[model samples]
Target: MNGVQLLLVIVGAIAVSGLAQRRGLQPALVITLVGFAVSFIPGLTRIELDTEIVLGIVLPPLLYSAALNFSFVSFARNFRPIVGLGVGLVVATALLVGVFAAWVVPALTLGTAFILGAIVAPPDAVTAVAIGRKLGLPKRVMSILTGESLVNDAAALTLFSITLAGVVGTHTLFANPVLLFLYSAIVGVAVGLLLAVVATVIRRLLKDSGLETVLGLVVPFAAYLLAEQIEASGVLAVVAAGFAIGSSSSRAGYQTRLQERQVWSSLDVLLEAFVFAYMGLQLRFVMEDLTAAGDSVWEIFGVGLLVLLVVLLIRPVWVFVSFGRHFLLDRVMRRRIASDTRVQERIRVENEQRIARGRRPRQFPVFLNWRESLVVSWTGMRGVVTLAAAAGIPLALADGTPFPGRAEIQAIAFIVAVGTLLVQGLTLPALIRSLHLSDPRQEEFDREQAEHALEVAQAASAGVYQRFLASPPEGVPPELLERMTQMVKRQSADAARDPDPDATSAYGEAFGTLYREVLQAQRNAVVDERDANRLDDDAAREFLEQLDYQEAAIVSRLGYRL
Candidate 1:
């Protein structure tokens, strides 16, 4: 697509997202539906989905954003289930779907069917997590969803690479697929951690929030593409970098963290909008090709239905066999993990422990209920990543006879993605409601979180007070300093009461109202300096930017999450 068409797509998607926002629906669903409707408009430009754009450019930031916001502690604690679902379940789904497709379709080769299975295997838990956030799903369940989304890409891509190697003529990776998997996982993680350290150093040296944030925006894409160039898992690379950065992000300047969060949120919305919109637009394309295969409409529906059922069913079954059965057996065996040192570390959350000044005795329950398993199963909606992987399949093999059943595979993939999204995504909220999960001890949980934030904020500001006492700024009175410190303490107390506050969610409206006059004064002064020629144009703009940033900061409660 040309620049005009691309701009139109983005602008149109955003507009539809706005509608979705107003209607309390997922923006992705709305964007896709809008794109499907717009496809029939007279003289509209057709935009093809590019695997490179989706995988290399788009997937990284989405994964990074999800990774950054997820609780690394929670993820680590739940790594067993996360891995079981993200990696093991993905493989199982592919194998089952491949077998089912080859049996039912009759035309698709086993290799092509496996490729299709791989394409649709990664459950786009982005929608699930987003919905869970709104619905107040249990923290443990939310962690599993978020964690699965973060790491599943690597598994699906690994499988895709191996299967694609079979389709084409690359036997090197196939000779010892386990070694290829190890190489990809190990090298991808190493590359991600290395890049994260480099990014952190650059961020510190730059010391400019805007510059640092711009670099932060690029970190995930860089991690993915660079890792891929070195024959590693690009998906794992992004996840690793995201986890590294997220773990240490507490050390970053508040301004940089705030700016980065806002930037990523906006970027994520835009990317999802474009992805689903383009996905819907391609429905016509995939279906047109499928028509030439001369399969009856019922036959087509039967094949699509089988793939969808397998994708959806394999998850709940896997969750039970992999996790639920283990839960039951653990009671009989009374087992404990071998890593006692690591188990000691997981006692209390690392963050809460830091506030407590050391590790504290704490008990955490890891349990899986049938309700949660059902929720997880119903949330297996294939997304743009699935579409991209399928689209990425090469058109021709080494001998170049139009990779067997390419059209059929693409058709199946597109159908499965749209089908799951519509059938499962739309129905998931209702399923959650039907499950009737109890309202947990919300008040107690909220109290603990409030106490944690209060302690952390006090610890942080105490160091600043100590620095000020060491060397008081010239012209600043001790009385004024004391008053400012007291005011900050009061605000921190107020903020401790906030449950979750992002840039968009204003937890400090009272503070914003109090500071409005001062912000206006700063804006006026900056404009006056520019008008009087006391400040150059660039200097005036820079001053205005800082003023705007501070003004925006008024609404946010930094370092507040529960």
Candidate 2:
């Protein structure tokens, strides 16, 4: 498409996305349907890009942006489940779908079918994650879903590479399939870490917030390109870089943090909207390609639907069967513990000791209840990556022969991507609602966190005040100093308690300085809590934002730049 068409698509996407958000609907689902509808309008140009550009340029920043915001602590805590879904489930789905596709499509070889499998294997869970966040899914469930979406692309793409090489009759470096995957993953991670360190150091040395954020934009692309250049998984490289950079975000200037957050958020919306709309717009062209290739339209469409069904069915089946074993095993262990008094006493004593040391009592890892399992099982919505990978299929192999069933594969992939979005994306919110799922434990944990936050802030404020009393600023009259000190105490104590934005501050030059100091202390305390893992990353961020606002307000009133 030309520049004018691209501009129109973006404008239309944003407008529709705004409407969807206002109506409390999933913007992605709305955007896809609208794009599909718009595609039928006369004289509309079909938008297309080279598959490599789509994956290389578009995929990295989105994944990197997500990784930057994701909590490393949370990611590590839920590593097992994330790997299970991201890697294990993706491989299973690819193999299963590949076998099914080859069985049904007689013209396609096993290698090409596997390529199709890899294309559709990873579900873009952006929509699911967004809906879950809005509807208040538990933290762990959100983490698993988010982490799965982050990691699965690497797995699928790696498998795609291996299969693609096989189809093209090219020899890869690693003779062993397992060794190839391991090399891709390990090298990808190493590349990401090395780049993250370099980016962080450069940003720190730059010491300019705007420059830092601008550099932040380049980091993802650089990481992706660098990893791919070395035959590593660029997806993992981007993710690793994001995680590393995000964890060090606290060290950057607050202005940098604030600016980077808004930049990435806006980028995410733009890219996501355009991608879904692009998916919708291409349906007509995908069909045309298949028809032009002399394939039976109805037969391809039927295969698409069956493949979609397989994609949908395999997730819940895998989730339940894989996770259910652990659930059942835990039940047996719990029953055994109940029957043995000695074992029960030992566990109780250990937990009590842990609690006594100001730590949470030891508990088993998160085992999803039936409701959670159901919600997870149904969240498979294939999206941008699938379409990109499918369209990326080479037209000719190394020997200059037409790639087998390329058009058919793209058609089926488009079908599955659109089909899952319609099928699962539309229904997931309703399923979550119908189940009446609530994480009371998460709610209580948040509540306790809020209380702890207040306590920490209060302590920090008290310490600041004590320090001010101990050493008065030079050259202030005793009477004025006394008055300023009283004002500082009142404001510090009431700062967080007052939620009224309109409340006028009594802070002048002297009081403002003291209040800013108090805010800084409180921020430090919260950061410490976060570093120690005593606070949830989300909660820590929220508290830190409040402090930032307060500091900004004081600085603004003082006619100073933050």
Candidate 3:
């Protein structure tokens, strides 16, 4: 296919995926399956495109957009677990699969097998977050999965690079892989931080919402390109920059929040659909490879199953063994020493309350819950990086003959990707239900927190009103305080209500009536000022813009139509 055909396919896939998402199916899965089916048509097999276009052009923006929306606070708080799953897990999976693939796949070299293992090691953030949101998992579980997916891509890419070098005999293990890994990681982080700081400073100076929003779009590309020029992982750079910006966003301004929400949400939807569609479109190449090696298909299938089993089983076993030692047995031993002390009694009561509330006791150093373990296991779906790495494999071997195991490797990678993404993702919700995992208490906690946050906002508004009453700002209207008072009271009431259908609907209707009146009054004031020439063209435009923002906020609060 030419450029135009590829573009059409992408756009069509996105449109279909959007409809599927609304109907409660995973857009990624739908798009991939459709793309795979389309590629089977006889004429469609000749489609050829630049692999770099997919990897370099498409990946950076998607990764950056995902990173920008990630929660830095939660990521930092859960750093240990995130690192364990992201960096450590990738390394472990690669080593295990590498050894097994070399032993099981008859003519494949250890280096080539290692490359295959590295290719499928990282999970896809787009698939993980999309499925997580659809399944309505708790914030903590989503946070863990999202964080792991973001960082693990870097780990997988780095491993792939090293293994690829080894495959061509350009590098050796004695060349110090550890040092190269550390160097790449450090450079990626430094580049990202430097670019993020520069972007922040520039945004502050301009302070124009449109300009700031455009700058946010460009920052990710800058991070990715600069890191790549320095021979570091662009994926790592984008993830680091995303964390930096998310952490700093609150101090930036309200406009930053509005702009980020608009920019990332649009980008997120488009990229999520496109990446999976690309994966599906490549299925024809994989299938062709399988058809030529029909007899070796069973060998490929066995290796794929072995890798999948290893990936799935290792996680739970590791968690159980680690948690048993650090949490359960250790806690019991500690409590035994404190048995005769008053502190022990206090601890016992605290543990009882924690148990009643479905919390792990404070004495445990590690999380021992089955729910957390299941989330970790279910989040192991690999996507774009795996496909890209597999596709990048050299087409020829040392004697210039075709690569011996190219088809087998591609087929195996495809199996793992589909198996994990479709089977595990689909079963995750049922697994959570069967495990009796409910996050109602977390929902209640969030509601209370929102109430407290709204109270603080109301108190600030009240304080502002009092100041305005004592000495209003010049040109401030007499009705400003009354309008502000009503707004504050409405917000407080909305916040206090349980986020349920009945309470939200009741408050929403009342707020809608008040909001329309307030909006109409503002519009009239703008018209009156313009007619009287009390406001210039520029001033009227600014006023309208501010009013538009306020109206959108009101609608969002009421959960009404935009």
Task: Write down the TM-score of every candidate.
Answer: 0.80, 0.90, 0.77
Structure candidate 1, residue pairs in collision: none
Give the candidate order by descending lDDT: 2, 1, 3
Comparing candidate 2 with candidate 3, which one achieves the higher TM-score?
A: 2
Tens digits of lDDT, candidate 3, 422-443: 7777786677667655576866
State which candidate, 1 or 3, has the greater TM-score. Answer: 1
What's the lDDT for all of these models? 0.72, 0.83, 0.68
lDDT of 2 by residue, 1-562 (tens): 7888889889999999999999978787788788888888898767877666778888888889989887888878788889999999999999999999999987688989999999999998888988898888888899899889888977898788778877977666687778878998899999999999999999899998899999999999999999988878788899999999988887776678878889999998898888878877877776787778888899998999999999999999989997789898898988998899999899899989988876677776668888999999999998777866776677788799989888788888888988898899889999999988867687889978877886877787777777776786665456666666566555554535432222343324556667778777888888787776677877887877777666655655563422
Q: Between 2 and 3, whose lDDT is larger?
A: 2
Sorting all predicted structures by TM-score, with the top scorer first, yields 2, 1, 3
How far off is model 3, as Cα RMSD? Answer: 10.4
Using lDDT, give the best candidate's number.
2
lDDT of 1 by residue, 1-562 (tens): 7888889888998899999889988777677777878887877656765556767887788888877766566677788889888988888888889989988887788887888888888999888887877787776787788788877877897788777877787544326767877888888899999999999889889988899898898999999999888777788888889988876664566577667778888998888888877777766655666676665546776788778877877877887776567777666443453446565456446647654754333444556777887788788988868876776767678787767777677777877887888889999888988887545785576555444433443454565555545665555456555654455445444423332224343323323333333444444544443444333333444444444555445545442311
Candidate 2 regions with alpha-carbon error over 4 angstroms = 23-25, 40-46, 165-172, 339-357, 440-445, 461-463, 477-517, 559-562
The clash count of every prediction, one per candidate, is 0, 0, 1
Clashing pairs in 2: none
* TM-score (C-alpha) between model 2 and the true structure: 0.90
